[model samples]
Target: MNNTVVVAIPATTANMGPGFDCLGMSLSLYNEIHMSLTPGFINIEIEGEGAEDIARDERNIVFCAAKRVFTEIGESCVGLSIKLINQIPASRGLGSSASAIVGGLVAANKLTGSRLSQERLLDLATEMEGHPDNVAPALLGGIIVSVFQEGKVHYLRVSPPEGLNAVVAIPEFHLSTHSAREVLPKQVSMKDAVFNLSRSALLVAALCQNRLEMLRVAGTDALHQPYRTKLIPGMNEVIEGALQAGALNVTLSGAGPTVIALTDGEKPAVNDAMKGAFQRAGVSCQVKNLKPTVEGARII
Candidate 1:
């Protein structure tokens, strides 16, 4: 048997339009975590993404997640060196933390003799991440629709349509998930609730069948984006620019400092337009032309 386990987990964009906490999809970018048993200690090393900002000690999220697994299974957590090769940007609303949680759990489970099934691993990952939207795709991959009900996760995975590309504009700043949620109203009007429900349903169905035309209407969200965009400067212009550049739909990726546009292969043009919009607004950003990935977290 292999003495080391490496888990490659994808980055995810959650809350796609009106789906709120229930919808998410995986991107091509990934974060990899490697683990090997040691004599008797816990050590964590990180590279890339949050290397300087993330903790190297037990306070690290990856270390904490791996430690949680041992505690959950009644085993002491020690004797492991976990290394994270992080690619997903932290606190950019791109599921960086979700990748870490899934990676840690999968690494621990693989080293512990695979005691949990994939579904169970997903549940554990969801528990650690506080929601299923991001972790669901990070662990299971593809476009995932998930709901946590009565302590169980129910989900459906859809393969992103062929010929579709994602143009992502990622800004340098960070947006805390807690801070983003803080601005949201505790109670929404019935009209707003119904608006979200219909849009969320349409977004899911249209994404599954590759109905590009439906996305324009389906992605009109009333739940979070309206409130969250207040935290993102020049957000409206960026969305309009992507639409003018031929994107089917543009939405905030997760709680967002990053925004993504769904396009029918005009990836580069859409990417440029988004960045230009931000630049015109005096904000600096990086852009990526990415495709959806079907593969989830796996040991290699």
Candidate 2:
């Protein structure tokens, strides 16, 4: 068997606009993990953005996924060393943990002679991720609509329309998904729930028909965003700026301080407007133009 395997998984933006935990798209940004079997104890390495203080041992997600796979198969092996080169920001709603989980599982699957099929790998990834939206798109690429039903995951892929670019405006602050969810109201008004459901359906229809104009209305959310916005200062300003600058739509980029705007023209204009809004609102932000990934996770 080959002693080493390297896997690359793309960053994902989930809950695009109004889909909540049901929609996601993969971005070009990636996290790469390399695994090699060695003699002694397990080891892990980290690099790039959030690596400065990340754990370098079994406590890491990569190591945890690898160990889960090994234990599941009842296989005992020599020590494993994992090198993680992360381009995705941690806890920024960019699927950083999803990438790690998928990358590690892919590495282990390859090293163990392909014990799992792609579907099986995805199931494992979804299990580790606690949600299918981000993991599905990260593992399969493109735009995905997913629902977890009766212990099974069902998903469909949709191609992004031409001239559509993802403008990610990342704020300097961090908002953990757990903390964000905690801030949401447990019960919503009937009117708000119906409003979100209607818009979410419209958003799906727009994506299906590649109707960029419809997104302006489709992206409206009454379920999560209204409640979550308080935790994300300047959220409304950024969205308004992106729309005013002619973006097709703008929404929370996950449970985020990072807002993603879908643009029909050159991304720079939208990015500039978004950054300016953040600045005017006294929040520091970085902007990046990301193309959708057609390819998902792959072994190298």
Worst 10 residues of 2 by lDDT: 70-79
Give lDDT: candidate 2, residue 48: 97
Cα lDDT for residue 175, model 2?
85
Candidate 2 local accuracy as lDDT?
0.86
For model 1, how does the per-residue alpha-carbon lDDT over 1-300 read when each residue is reduced to its tens digit?
358999999999998888899999999898999998875777778889989999888788888888777887788876789888988889998899999998989898888888778888888888878889999998888999998977779999999888878888999899999999998999999999999999999988898888988998999898788898789998999999999888999999999989989998866678888999999988899998877889888888
Alpha-carbon local distance difference test for all models? 0.88, 0.86
Candidate 2 clashes between residue pairs 3 or more apart in a chain or in different chains? none
* TM-score, candidate number 2: 0.96
Pairs that collide, model 1? 38-79, 41-79
Give stretches of model 1 more than 4 Å off.
none
> TM-scores, in order shown?
0.97, 0.96
Error (Å) of candidate 1 at residue 219 is: 1.0
Candidate whose TM-score is highest: 1
